[model samples]
Target chain A: MAALKDIIARDYGTPAVVIDLDIVTHNIARLQAACEARGLENRPHIKTHKSPELAAMQREAGAAGITCQKLGEAEIMADAGFDDILISYNLIGEEKIARLAALIPRARIIVAADNPVAVDAYAEAAKRAGKPLEVIIECDTGRKRAGVESVADAIALAERIKASPQLRFAGFMLYNPEDAVAQTQAFLDEALAGIRGLGLEASIISTGGTPNLSNLGRIRGTTEHRAGTYIFNDRMMLACGAAELADCALHVYTTVVSRAGPERGILDAGSKTLTSDIGGLDGHGLIREFPQARIARFAEEHGFLDLSASSRKPAIGDVVRVIPNHVCVVVNMVDRLIAVRGDEVVGEIPVAARGRIV
Target chain B: MAALKDIIARDYGTPAVVIDLDIVTHNIARLQAACEARGLENRPHIKTHKSPELAAMQREAGAAGITCQKLGEAEIMADAGFDDILISYNLIGEEKIARLAALIPRARIIVAADNPVAVDAYAEAAKRAGKPLEVIIECDTGRKRAGVESVADAIALAERIKASPQLRFAGFMLYNPEDAVAQTQAFLDEALAGIRGLGLEASIISTGGTPNLSNLGRIRGTTEHRAGTYIFNDRMMLACGAAELADCALHVYTTVVSRAGPERGILDAGSKTLTSDIGGLDGHGLIREFPQARIARFAEEHGFLDLSASSRKPAIGDVVRVIPNHVCVVVNMVDRLIAVRGDEVVGEIPVAARGRIV
Candidate 1:
């Protein structure tokens, strides 16, 4: 193994995603420790890295299985020998239902559904497979994306799952904004009371999101914490004060391809690599060496770096590391991530679930 | 071949990029005719489709050559039997220069450079390969992207390319906004005059951009027009009045995974598939079936569909078609695109040049 810089200089190409396994291991340990100290099970979401290798590290570090946002990702992880998978999305359509039923014999799959249309499909799939499927009711706290609106709807969905002979009502799950944590907690607590009133014991009250990682055990009824982006903290995490820049393990190594003028420079990496997911951030990403230079905009293959704010300028051919605004999207863009341990190139980790967006 | 509806019902998965070959062939012929009528060479930029098959279709439709935005794409096209390639980007860094030099023998490689740094790299790569590489001067032309600022700088860079024994100075290229066409034409005219004064022929004055496609031969002295998105018009194209909704050839077929409420629904495809590229549009994309429904926002695997505006709403298991705000980024996200003819499933076209960001 050579130094990371040496390996980058000798082997890696420009505009590549490089991951530091040393920091990854540390980040995993940190999150595991946080969950353990708070009496909560840590279910590391695989959407962040989309790598079975990284998910294995999290599981070995004492994670309670893994979480996937889609059935496609879950199928990939199950193929990679990851059991007890939780797909935090409604499995709709006959195709997905049939696929989910087929996946039952391979691993324990827990699904989330906010409506009966999804619940009926899950029931159909479960009955088709002749096996009981675990399901959780998704309650809308404040995310405004997908979830049942009221506690009554949550209880009704729970009853519907309970009524299905092939389905087991696990509990509730909610993904809310950081500001709506208190509201979400109250709704979950009330929903729990309603479910408990039906003589049903809620096994898992799952709450997730990387931004909500810090408030894991603080949410009273949350039995498990699911987080994804903490494995490789990005600029968004840094902006939210959740992680320091040193904790960012994944960085895009891009070369300055064009210094159009003194005020403007262009990097080889752009929306295709770094992504246009600003997420209300100031810029696309953070340049490690040139901290003051703002990534103003991006074309498909060109990242416009505003060099006017910085006294230090990068020359053409100079490779700079960038921590993307959202690391998950960046990981989804590439086929494989360059794995590095400290200052050495470890290996290439295939993003087996990179484009599994079924 | 089975009908597309039948194929999708029996085989295809949700959240897929579907390309109508009928429309693609029509688009190619239409653009080629437009260019030919204007006495301009149509050099189709492969960045939109990122498929060698589609690029070959352009070639068969009478395109002079193919235009790639990166050396990696050029290499892919060359490997796929494309003999003529114009990589409309600066080849920077030792590795890229070496790759470019090696590719010169495989195809007719034309490189674009805005500064001495890129010109010098092209010269070095050419000298190493012991073959003359064609080089073009990229003018800024009010796009504020990569290009020389003034006529003097353009002339200086052209002279530098001409001075290199291994480099051939081959006129100019500009990608300007639709509003900046007149300004860009003025600048290019002056630069062409200056180059002619230096006893240079300036044979290839290439101007490109899908938005500027209507001004194909209107710009005086421009010999070639490079348009990408016309082959698969997107929502942005529709909004910009470049193409009608019917002209959109590429669309994402996504299933409604959750009808969270009466006004809100969620699609399986999100930023990962459709992308978060708003590009000054009202929403992320245009829903073909539900024209009034807006794709409000996106999570990683969930597209938040605001259906308040539409009388008809999508239910769980219902799949809808979406024309993305930017088609190029969507094509880059997937490994393969489903090809169809009218209502029939033709085949799958592998996006061979996709993710070739370097």
Candidate 2:
């Protein structure tokens, strides 16, 4: 593989998301192998890449299926002939339900619902479509974002889904707990037993996050793992000890547009490209070569690069690659990714599911 | 105009950017009136509202021209029949220069540059196009983002632009200084005198920001103002006392997807919709009806609403409006704006210049 600078010089304009296909293939295989070793299904989340081509690669790489966060993304993937999908979000409102109804017959999609309102809506959409929509109860194992609060609540929701004619109670879903893994495991264990006692099969125990990839086998009942950021591991993943810097595949290729002050260099990418998602990292992104240079601030289009600590300052028009704080948001901001193989410009992969926020 | 709730009920799905066109028109006229009363040319920055239609409306309301932060945005506006454009940021690299060369023949474009490197590139592009491109020297008048550090540097840059046969030296450009207006005025006053002493006509003295709109006519030798956020006043503008809550024209219409606990509610919109730009505000956005509910945190597709303080809690599937922290970024996140006039949805306007980072 040629140096990144060579690839950048030969192929890119400024502020492009450059993806190394070699690294991407390696990342997919690594995660897949890890999941397979743990006797777990690798249902790679499509939120990070938002590319049908990339999702296709994951499906081809001994993965169980794909996971999407939104109905719009799932629709795009379904359009591209993805059969099995898990929309890991509450499908709310009448408009979404109508869309879900239309989508039910096209492919196998399992949606996770935490509240009874969402479960009822999914059931309505399923009834309308005349096809049973598989649903998993989102248990609040530890992540207090969205889920059933207790084991009893999880069982109640599972029973509710089982009562509905157009719904199938799949199992339980939880975003992999970071530090409270044991507590979360206990909650899931009790919930699973409770669910099984209700004469329902808890086939899919989906628990995942890129940061908790190391605990794949350690988790008691995690039948499938859903990880998004592992495809293009970023500074956040590196900080969490999930992946190394070399493992990151996606990089924001930007040009130093200004050196207004002796120590301050401004790049063409800012919140619009790199995003303001710091993800508890030091700076907006990590400058690959100029490691000491901090991306101090951002205008809509200008990235303020603080080169005070760095010995290597990027001169005006000098192209540099930045590994962003959160790769998922970075990918969401762009329409396409500049695909590269070493120094060669391989192709352009359209982010077909980009800005599918609904 | 009809109530916002009626509009949401009739016309919106969750996670939509609903623009009140009447309010947008009123906001445009208000800014234009303020600029006109002060004898300043109103060149509304298109970075906030990337729609060519809104740009057209601004032009109709007596704006001198449109200001764009990127070359890609300028191209989009030019394609939509905008002939006079002021690209506020420095256009860097060979690819940008080549595009600028192509753009010169089609439009009356004025570009700002703070350094010799950028000035040289503009001259090269002008030379390639066989046209004299009007260039302005950006002076660091306290806003310290991108500009020449001193009056002497500004004069030197102006001279460099003047020396090039293909370039015409237009005046100076400065982002409106907030509290340091007196010092910035002194710098600009000296720079203006210095440029005039060199037998160069400083025709355009551009200084602007929505926050500094109150200081419009107070600043000496200011010919034009560039403000973007006023078109769709956000919580940032409201916090700065630049706008009233009623003055806010654009809002994110979202649905309450979950009520995990009695005090906790989660909306379908998150960082992807509302964005992570807090702009030093309290929360991610202001819930219109439930002012006490804080947008505490965000997952990729879920907005955690802290409803502990709010008396009015949104029920599941209930659509609500959100005024984002920074409106400019919120506009950039979506593809189209749901244009409304009270209860009636006028049309869907495509954000033609969205994600034009380069």
Please give, for residues A1-358, the per-residue lDDT of candidate 1 as tens digits: 2245545744767888999999999999999999989888999999999988999999999998899998889999999999899989988777888899899888998999999999998999999889999998888887888899889999999899989999999998878788887888789888988988887888998888888886777778778989999999999999998899889999999888778688899998889889899888998999988999999999988899899999999998788889999999999998899988877788999998988888
Segments in model 1 whose C-alpha atoms lie over 4 Å from true places: A1-10, B1-10
Q: How accurate locally is residue B165 in candidate 1, as Cα lDDT from 0 to 100?
A: 94
How high is the DockQ of candidate 1? 0.69
Looking at model 1, the pairs that clash are: A4-A343, B4-B343
User: Model 2: residues >4 Å from true position, as ranges?
Assistant: A1-12, B1-12
**DockQ category of candidate 2:** medium
Evaluate model 1: give its lDDT: 0.88
- Residue A51 of model 2, lDDT score: 89
TM-score of chain B of each: 0.97, 0.97
Q: Which candidate number maximizes DockQ?
A: 1
lDDT of 1 by residue, B1-358 (tens): 2245446744767888999999999999999999988899989999998888999899998999999998889999999989878988877767777788799888788999988888999999988888898999988877777888899999998889878899998989988877887898889889988888877878798989888986777789889999999999998899888999778899888888887688999998999998888788888988878999999999988899999999998877787788899999999998999999888888999999778877
User: B1-358 in candidate 2: lDDT tens per residue?
Assistant: 3265555544456788889988999999999999999899998999999999999999999999989999999999999999889998887777788899999999999999988889999999999999999998887766667898888899899889878999999898888568878888888888878878889988898887899887886778889999999999999999999999889998888888888888998988998988888788888999887899999988888899999999878898788889999989889998998898877778899999898887
